[model samples]
Every structure is written in structure tokens, then in C-alpha cells.
Target: MLAHSFMSDEKKQNSPRPLILAVEDHDDNLVLMSYALESLGCRFICQKDSTNTVLVAKEYQPDLILLDILLPTISGIDVVRYLQQDALTCNIPVVAVTALASREDKERILKAGFNAYLSKPYMIEELETVIRRLLCGKIDSTSGFELCKE
Candidate 1:
């Protein structure tokens, strides 16, 4: 299986693309994230196995990480803890993207050190906003997208 997942677009070459590390176990979810990143003119590295996440993050040092909370072997929270402890990968921003939509779940996720929390079945615009906000520190209001509330 390919460890990295992305779709190339020549039009995005005018400028450097932001590198994103996506940790998702499901193929469909990876595809969806790939589409989103492609549309945003960004490059991404994907890992289906959570156990290798910290290793990959340290190696690639992506600008941002989209992580799923639940995984087959190790939970995303554990992965985050590993990343946080590693000086090489500690500075990268991590966003929780999962099905955990309850208010308490969101709070717990934020408390666990995720820079942002985005629930599953999210809108494309919402995904873009969060990515831009965390990576760029601000959203482009000209995109006419509003913040999504959970």
C-alpha cells in the first residue's frame, strides 16, 4: 500500500504548496482528504497505520496534520502525544478529523492538544477554512466561506 496519497495538479505549481500529513485509516476518507487538499493547491502525505505516524511526521515535517482520533493499533491521541514529545515534530499543527461530534468529545480532543477539531461529514469549505486558519494563521474572507460550528 502507498504510504503517501495525493493528486497532482500542474496549476498549483505557481507557488510552493503547503505540505500536509494526513493520518486516516479508511480509504474513502483518504480520498476525500486528497480531493480537499488538491483543490486547495497543497501537497499531502498520508498514513493509514497510526503506529507509523510519528515516524512519518518526523521524517516529513509537514506544515499541518489532519488526524483521526480512532485507529486500529494505536489511537490518534497517543500518536499526538508521541509527536508532542518529539522535538522534530512537536511544532507541526494537528487537527482532529473524526466522527466524534459530541460537545464533550470536541472538548476532550482540544484538550488533548489538537489545534482544531473538525467533525466527519464536513463541508469542503469548512475543511479549507480550518486548514487555512491553522496553516496561514488567517482565512481569506474573499472565499466567502463562514466558520463552521459543530
Candidate 2:
């Protein structure tokens, strides 16, 4: 199921608010994430799993993606790989939001293709900071997208 955060067409057209694609399966986590994204003034689309992640990313072209490494069918590492290989969604930043907090796990996830990593139980401020940094000049300008490309 894809749940979209409500944003009026007029507001979306006139404002520079970033659109996010959040791929997380846990219901509690999704609720918390939804609140945080909305509080940070972002419009987001939520996917419960990685089943249609690539397709959604291509169609929505979100400014950022918050992905859970442990998903139902496919892992988030594999999902990021797919996104990187696609021209349409390649430059979009993807962040790993997972419980794997070990140093080796972080290194492996980043190596796999995620632009950023946020361990589970992250503060809302951390989420805000990551979103701001990634979305800044990301939509129109290509300044911060070099990380995504690599």
C-alpha cells in the first residue's frame, strides 16, 4: 500500500517543499516517520515494502528516499542498487533507516549504494538535518547530487 502525505496541488506547485519516498514496513515506525516528515514540512509517499520501490521512484521522482534495509521481499541494499542503475531515479538520494548500527553494517550499506545512513531510534532532529542537507539545491541545482551519483 502506498500512503501519500496530503499536500494541496496549489501548495505543491507554488512551494519548494521536498517530496520524499519512505519505504518502511513496521506500522509504528511508519507513523513516527510520517509525523516527523510532516513536521519538517515535507510531502511524502510511504511504501510498506520494496515490491514496487523502483517503479514508484521512477514515477514520483522524489527528492529523497528513506529506506529500511530489512524489508519483506527485497532488501533495501538491493533496492538502492536498482535505483542507482536507473537513469530516471539514479540521482535521487536514498538514506538507509535501519537497526543495523554496527560500524561494519554502516560501511556495507553505504557501499551498496545508499547516500546516507540513519540507525534506528534516530532523533527527529537527525532526520531533519539529513533531509535539509540532501534536499538543499537538489531539485533544481545538482550541487549535492554528486554523492548520489557515486
Strongest candidate by lDDT: 2
Report the C-alpha lDDT of model 1 over 72-144, residue by residue, as the tens digit. 8789888888899999998999999999999999999999999999999898788888998998743233442
Q: What is the overall TM-score of model 1 with all chains considered together?
A: 0.82
- Candidate 2 lowest-lDDT run of ten: 138-147
Which lDDT values do the candidates have, in the order given? 0.80, 0.81
Segments of candidate 2 deviating more than 4 angstroms: 1-15, 137-150
Q: Write the per-residue lDDT of candidate 2 for residues 1-150, one digit (tens) a residue.
A: 544343323333535778888889898888888887766666788888688889888987788999999997899999999999999999999999999999999999999988899999998768877877888753433323333357
Error of 1 at 6 (Å): 6.7
Off by over 4 Å in 1: 1-15, 137-150
